[model samples]
Target: MAKKVRFYAGVEIDKDGIRHTWSADAWQQFMDSCKKESQAFEIRGRKIAGQCESCYSPAVFYMHLTKSRELSDWPEAGDASGSVSNLATRRDQTGIISILEYTYLLPVSGTPYIALLRSSSGPMPSAIADWVSLKSDMPAAGKSFELQPVLRNDARQKLNESLGVKSLEVRFEGKPDPNSTSSIERAAAEAASTIDESDYANVKVDMSISMGRATVVSNSTEAMRKQALSILTNNNIAKHPIKDMLSKGWVTKLKAKTLQANPESDKPIIEPVDFIKEHLTEDADFGSMKDDEMTPEIILSGMLEAIGKFRKRSNEY
Candidate 1:
């Protein structure tokens, strides 16, 4: 499967300490400087080992994450002749690991877009920000920069969707600690004391209820279930209990049902890389330009165009 790229927005503070979004012009200047001075930069106290390849254009750069470190020893493993042996530790031995990763940067009039190839061994967003900062124009007093992911709307949309709940079932089971200062805990303690002070320490609350639009069904004690739906929905029948449970963390087991005619849309969460690729094509009409293999210049051009389209979508929304 092809790897996906995660997107981000670049924000920078100027000498006056005013925050501003980076622009394409800003990115262009940064990349040009990087091309001119593509020396190994330090991150996490480690510098690029050797032959640091700095591939850059107006909007992108390939970060060669090569590092050298002392190799103390190797674990017991079979050699080429198929004989297992415990390798001895060698403090003087050193090893080098090389990794090639790409990050695309394209800033609009506002914040710039940064797209990075997502990989298990790739640098994190914060590390990427630091890497870019190193290549950035010499910092003025108070000047700094940051890179943040362009989050998907799924989380917000899911909150509003509310599973289109038609019914809700909740089960709460646990003993509240007597020492807890929470009002709920105190209420539980009081109820346990009323049941039997001798057994208060062993008391537990096991309550279950199922609520529909206009009716609630439960065999549990009336007081325990009383006003539960009200407490959850704040007297709003149209609201779902899930929201309350999420906010309060009071509900233990939850079973929610939606109308069969209008079933809830529980779309699978798209991976960051896949999400970006699909949007690039759907929203940006990014076609053949998304080639499997291309020259550095071509890749930069394609990414630059795609980012512009993304900026438009970002503005429209």
Candidate 2:
């Protein structure tokens, strides 16, 4: 899988009622400085929020870095063995410091639809101890952020300068699927062709199963499309896993039904026997068996054996 590069910053307000924003550059500089000073910073009371802006359809994100940490390690330099002493001999220490942030995502001028993030945060003073003792007074936000970070191919050239990351060429992992348009715009244009209702229904059910939730009832086709896209993209479901799940689930359901059927009857149900016979016929060794050789007793034994093998394979997967 290709790795994605993301830019982030901290925003905060000080006790003196002054607000500050830290750009991605500033954050990177601070991190470098920390490394030079042989110290580490820890995030405290981290909170994040996201909302969709109406006009440009831009995504707005907010984050609060309530506190910071100053960390120090003992024996500043490693011993001759290139290993530091154990915890008993080591003197590691850290302290919590004050910091806060207010982040904004706004549309960039000229690029009417594109969103640009401006992050602000308070500065950390060097006077603070590298390993001062302090208690955490920040409250937990108790919320999670679920937004997927999107890096548009078009914006790569503009962002590469300051971000210092190379632009990634959007290349397919394998030969493009000939059945579907390889480009999003072309796919959208092609989708105008009439589609079967049964196909739509199957897609809805598959999306619901992939998300592990019931599909939201919606009258709008656009809404349904968005829901399905969100589930598929965020979950990153591959084709093989989905196909495997469907096949296994189908077999499991059929096995359950077969076991439940004819509980009151002395003889076994025909469904399981038929299922076993179908599988056995697929085997090269068993394919040579004549119809007359498959007696009722043989069928029952084959069904039991098939069921055992099916369960073992299922467990492995």
Candidate 3:
């Protein structure tokens, strides 16, 4: 049998700062109208306030199902108006009970209604929870409601069975001083000066990139992962290579392997030469370097190159 889905109805408010309320009679009428149309209750950017000169912007109110639960007899705004009216009346008489299931006011603007609902619940599905937490915002506008926890563990397990990864750490040096305005000024001043490669030798940019093991069970689909990373990058969560590194498809592939491998039995995958080649500046002369020839300076230079490419590509996009 196909899995059942349940949906709940809520009010959506448009405009940045306006409030609307439904009178008992108006609410009943609205419910009746929804039932007549066989549609969930929605206000299409209509002005609710009387005597207000400024028109409220268009907004949409709609119903959607919760991620984990499946319940029956969810009142449909247009198809089951009577059922919804009856439920609302009962809640009013009984002083608010759970018979109506979930109901909340959706603010007109500034906050996303779906995000507000998600916030009330526990952790979101693993795929998005981290990215959502990091961005501390709803997914970008058009994509907001599309994020659904549709990938079940069985599917993930199947994917896990096909892929493997090796856990590795990439360390880079020579980060700039965030607090030093003078350093920035100096760089600006030196923009026209002759290049001095040795001046950067003592500069320490201490950073570590954790190439986390991927697992089928906890992993999100590649598309979802990429979306999450894009959101992070667009929001400027971290500088360059950190953001760029995580966005790589290989990283996702590696993570899947890492997660599936037995910690005690599987050996970690290592490919220093491949890693360097992918991330390093193509213009740089590596001089027939072998995997064993990989140096800290070379790795750091590659990382910096990757960062530059990421910045350039992002600007182009």
Clashing pairs in 1: 107-112
lDDT of 2 by residue, 1-317 (tens): 11111121123334453434444553344334333222223323322222222221122222211222122221143666897553324433223232223222222112212111211122111111111111112123221112222222322212212211111111111111112211321232234223442232122111011211222222432332333222211221212222312111111010101111246864333211111112111111112354435322333233333334333432221
Give the best candidate by TM-score: 1
Highest lDDT model number? 1
Which stretches of model 2 miss by more than 4 angstroms? 1-46, 49-109, 113-223, 229-317
Give the winner by lDDT: 2 or 3: 3
For model 1, how does the per-residue alpha-carbon lDDT over 1-317 read when each residue is reduced to its tens digit?
Answer: 22234455666867886767677677656655555444566766645321223445553344433333323323354556787654433222323232343333333434555554322223444455556666564363557666544544642122223323333343322233333323344454455555543333234444323332422223332332222322221111111122322112222333333222223443322111121212222112223543545445654555565556566666332
lDDT minimum window of 10 residues, candidate 1: 232-241
Worst 10 residues of 3 by lDDT: 46-55
Over 4 Å off in model 1, which ranges? 48-111, 137-140, 152-317
> Could you tell me the TM-score of candidate 1?
0.39
Candidate 3's residue-wise lDDT over 231-275, tens digit each?
221111112223222111111111212333345755433222222
Candidate 1 positional error at 97, Å: 6.6
- Against the reference, the lDDT scores of all candidates come to 0.40, 0.24, 0.25
TM-scores for all candidates: the values are 0.39, 0.18, 0.18
